[model samples]
Target: MSLNGKVAIVTGSGQGLGFAYTRELARQGAAVVINDVNADTAAQAVAQIEADGGRATAVVVPVGTTDAAKALVAGAVDTFGRLDILVTNAGILRDKSLLKMTDEDFDLVINVHLRGTFTCVREAYAYFKEHNVRGRIITIGSPTGQRGNFGQTNYAAAKAGIVGMVRTWALEMKRAGVTVNSVIPVAATAMTKTVPYFQKAVEADERGEAMPAFFRHDLGFGTADDVSGLVAYLASDEAASITGQAIGAGGDRLQVWTHPEAATTEYREGGWSYEALQENAGTLFTAETLQSYGEEFLPLPEDLKPAQAAEAR
Candidate 1:
């Protein structure tokens, strides 16, 4: 009800977290434009919304092209008469170690996740500025992006870049009353179901069983619907003051990630010569104790981890 009378566009809404986002928006009374590359899934999403007495339409497009982006914004305005929210939820993953990853794999992932978000947000902002609408733009991010992952070079780059863009856009859109922020969500979706680290949790979810406390509390992993409320809240009037932030949500956990900053700074009269830096290297970074690399899992419960992963851990 908080989003009643609003119009929203959620890319990649054919299924998974994207679908959950659109469904939540529609439930709150927004007329949604569900976009996805697959026509069947898009139509199915629209039908589901309509069955629930919520208004929605399907916009089938790849979303990485400017033309596709243009069509999405136009579809929202053309179908619902205006656009108030744009949630860039469409993305793809091609995971491989840096050495094994090919150019095609990297490019494909970047095209869908990074370029797709860029094109969609650019067009959405243009519409907002032209119509003088104080629109909400929610971009998706990932934990792998925040904390480096072993085989997610492209994905991490794209997602981190998205948050970086949000910070800049927040400053630029301040006068326009447009809020842009990144939601770094961890959830059990098609995208994450195959992750060996979460195989057990995913199986439990698929069977309609609750995820173990270790995953929900310690790992911040949960079903897609658990992350939707934050997306909806960020897109509503109440979150107008929130922008330029990277918020994390999954299961019962919510976190506000601090922006990158210098943890230790010392007086440098001449910006420090190499010889002086080498001498002070020991004490320069001592205060922060070297931030941990990769996401720190809190030791999964023995029964909750994949057999091999559990054995390895």
Candidate 2:
């Protein structure tokens, strides 16, 4: 798990999960580019990594912008001479149900998650392609993308989009030897813990008021480090063959295969037509409909059913 001589960039590394990823990668011998909107936090993170005898430099930029994304890559290349790994871990949440969701809220979330990820991936792809380099791209996804969660319509859609992006990029970059994958992590972080709603959810669960089926006490919940470990592995050369994958990581648990179940369906032919299509559309669209759309197969082991394991962790 040594990243010796590797040049890596981690967005939102000023704190939380991104910070953990940056520090860990630096500690593993990779020259890290720490990115965040907060200059002080980013600088402090880099300083801490350096204090631990790790190589790191901070780049203050809002990761959702295209220019900033390019700057992040350029900074990595300029500082370390090459770009090897990228972790697009910058994101924000504006949780709201579809009905209650505002356009501004939706735009903000999409800009951060989908647009932000696109910005980073596009720049990295250009670098990797131009340099004829094989790079590793790992994005942060959420369980909300796997199983729908209440009050997170925007988050879920964005996360699901990331998985789709990874799949497409994996194929597009295959010729260049780059691999694209996403990590669907369940971690307790500042973003989650700081949210009043989230705190209530956790408190409720603790009081046995509305425990999620996957709740587990000994699993110690999830932390930033837990998710970073998986990100590190995905970016490693050992995982070269593991592109277009969505993995789950946490304490006392590691479920790499997280996807919707499958089923058969039908579609209406053209001219048979608007009314008929409208009536049958709901039946045609389901998690089952999406199962065959991707190339990777990472379904969980039969005994490790996700629904049941919800209790263990």
Top candidate when judged by TM-score against the true structure: 1
lDDT of 2 by residue, 52-117 (tens): 998888888887889989899989988889999999999988987789999999999999889999
lDDT agreement with native, every candidate: 0.92, 0.79
The segments of candidate 1 whose C-alpha lies over 4 angstroms from its true place after superposition are 308-313
Tens digits of per-residue lDDT for model 1, 62-169 = 979999999999899899999999999999888999999999999998898889999999999999999999999999999988998989999999999999999999
Using lDDT, give the best candidate's number.
1
Query: What is the TM-score of each predicted model, taking all chains together?
Result: 0.95, 0.78
lDDT of 2 at 15: 90
Residue-level lDDT for 10 in candidate 1: 97
List CA RMSD, all candidates.
1.7, 7.6
lDDT of 2 at 112: 87
